[model samples]
Target: MLQVRLLGCFALEQSQRDQSAVLGRNGRRLAAYLFAYPNRSHRRDKLIDLFWTESAPDQGRTAFSTALWKIKRTIGASGRQMALHAVGQNVVLEIAKPAIVDAHRFASDIEVALSASCADSIRPAIELYSGAFLEEFDGDWVLEERERLEVLYVRALTLMMRQAANQSRYEDALCCARRILATDPMRESAQRATMLLYTLNGQRGQAIRQFERCRATLREECGVDPMPETRSLDLMIRSGAVFERIPTLLNETFGTGG
Candidate 1:
């Protein structure tokens, strides 16, 4: 099996062989673009523009053709099996059988989890999403796909936090919230979840410190203050009122639904 890992550092892994002859940068990009949006045909001209826009028409076509050949050679049978081919000016990646694409699998698993409304079912999706989709690549297309996956990751963490909280798994919930904050420090909801979990664990001092950490992150990152809701939580922690409430609207705050 040839596994294309787009999450975290991008690497193409084959189950039974060395990947010494990896694709070139442009080859990798073409492979990633096709794998990221599998089973679709992309016009050769569009791919040329996307990846080799600065080149003259001939140079771009030459570069694209070279990159395509490199990709085919690097990925070999799996590439052929998946129909990673060009036909009459269109390129395609068609995987009729199973293939492990972390980006694609992450999105699919999340949809299933969301459909079931079961955060527990989402654990695999969260685990699959090790990092932003193709974090090493750059381009307009890469940025859009990266940001979209990042948002899904954050939302998945939100669901996990709420689930663990409901299950009284305070530590697990806090861990999920921290993971979310690590990726998106501006997420006040995650910060709040962290603070609440600390409080629930009888770590009031830690809860207050989390609030301070949140404030500092916002100040340094965005030159802004915490939202009013966050400030209120901070005040509640300071006044020893956090333990008095159950973090009301438990279902409302972290719900992934409408």
Candidate 2:
């Protein structure tokens, strides 16, 4: 079985060995495109338009043909049944046996986790998101799907964080919160969550410092102050007030809930 990894980096592995070198860079991109839309027939002309636009029409056609042929040859040499097929005017990726596409599996696992009540069910999906979708590749075609998967990744992390906090696992919850902030420093809700978690973990100084960082980030990026709720939280913490779980506050604020 061919394992296609479209998350983080682009790789095609078979029998636990890397086969990406067989396709080279451009060949890998072409193959990755087909796997990104697996089992779907993509018109050859459309592919030429997408990948060979920089060349003259004749040159583009020749390049497209060469790329497609290379893809076919590489897959054929894998010692497995054909994974690429030419049907009528379109090309299709139809692995004879099951293939593991990380993007597909991530979506499927996350979908199942979303519908389940058990928080632990989300772990598998979270672990599958190794990094941004196709982190090494970029184009107009990749943006929407990349953003979509990133949103799912952040959502999964947030769910895990809240569940851990609810269970009084401050350290674990803080880890998730920090990851969220790392992915998106502009996320004030995650910043707030981090602050709260730090205080809960008996690190009041770090909590105050987190607030200062949030205030600085918002001011620098948006030229604005922290939201009122965040400001209030900062004040309470600075005044040495007793802390409590303010998940409700996070939910009602101008950003995603903690």
Candidate 3:
């Protein structure tokens, strides 16, 4: 079976053998786009527009055809199992059954987990997302898909973090909160959550330091102070009024205590 890992880097493996080197640069890009949206038909014209916008129509068509042909030649016999097909006015890349595409699988798993409101069930999907979707590529299409997947990833992380906190797994929840901040440092909610988690884990000093970091980040990045709620939480923590009610406080403040 062929596997395409387009999560962090581009990789192609067939029968446990690396085949990424066989496809040249253009072939790799063409294959990446097709496999990124497996089983869906992309209008040939649209594909041409996306890949060869600078060329004349005839020239673009030739380029698309040549690039696609090179991909097929690279696949050779595997083309029978996983092949590109012309369906009416569209081109479809058909992935063989049992083939793995990390991007597609991650999106599907995250969607199902979110739809079912089973945040804990998304761990597998979270594990699959090693990094940003196609971190090596940048195009309008790639950017759109990247952003969409990132939102889903962050949402899954948030849900899992809340679940962990509810279970009193402070360290795990803190890890997730840190990941969220890494993705978007401007996420005040995550910043606040991190601080609360640190305090809940018996690291009051660390929590206070976290607040300072948050304040500095907000001031440097947005030229603003932490939100009023954040400030109030900081004061409550410093006064030690909220220590005894950490669980209830987390629950009320961010739905983490459950």
**Candidate with the greatest lDDT versus the true structure:** 3
User: Would you list the rank order by TM-score, best first?
Assistant: 1, 2, 3
State which candidate, 1 or 3, has the greater lDDT.
3
Which TM-score value belongs to model 3? Answer: 0.86
What's each prediction's TM-score? 0.90, 0.87, 0.86
Ranking under lDDT, best-scoring first?
3, 1, 2
Q: For model 2, what is the error of residue 192's alpha carbon versus the real structure, in angstroms, after optimal superposition? A: 1.0
> What TM-score does prediction 1 earn?
0.90
Cα lDDT tens digits, model 2, 18-118, are 77776766667787788788777899888878777678899987777777777777567656545677767799887554337888889878877877745
Residues 1-258, candidate 1: write the lDDT tens digits: 688788876777887553524667776777788888888788999899888878899998998998888777766756445656788988887777533777888888887887787887888778888777778888888889899888888877777888888878889988988899889888887888788779878999999999999999899989999999889988987898755666463544554231
Q: What is the alpha-carbon lDDT for the whole of candidate 3?
A: 0.83
Output the worst ten-in-a-row residue range by lDDT, candidate 1.
249-258
Q: Residue 106 of candidate 3: its Cα lDDT?
A: 90
Residue 59 in model 2: shift from native, Å?
A: 1.4
The weakest ten consecutive residues by lDDT in model 3 span: 72-81
The TM-score of predicted model 2 comes to: 0.87
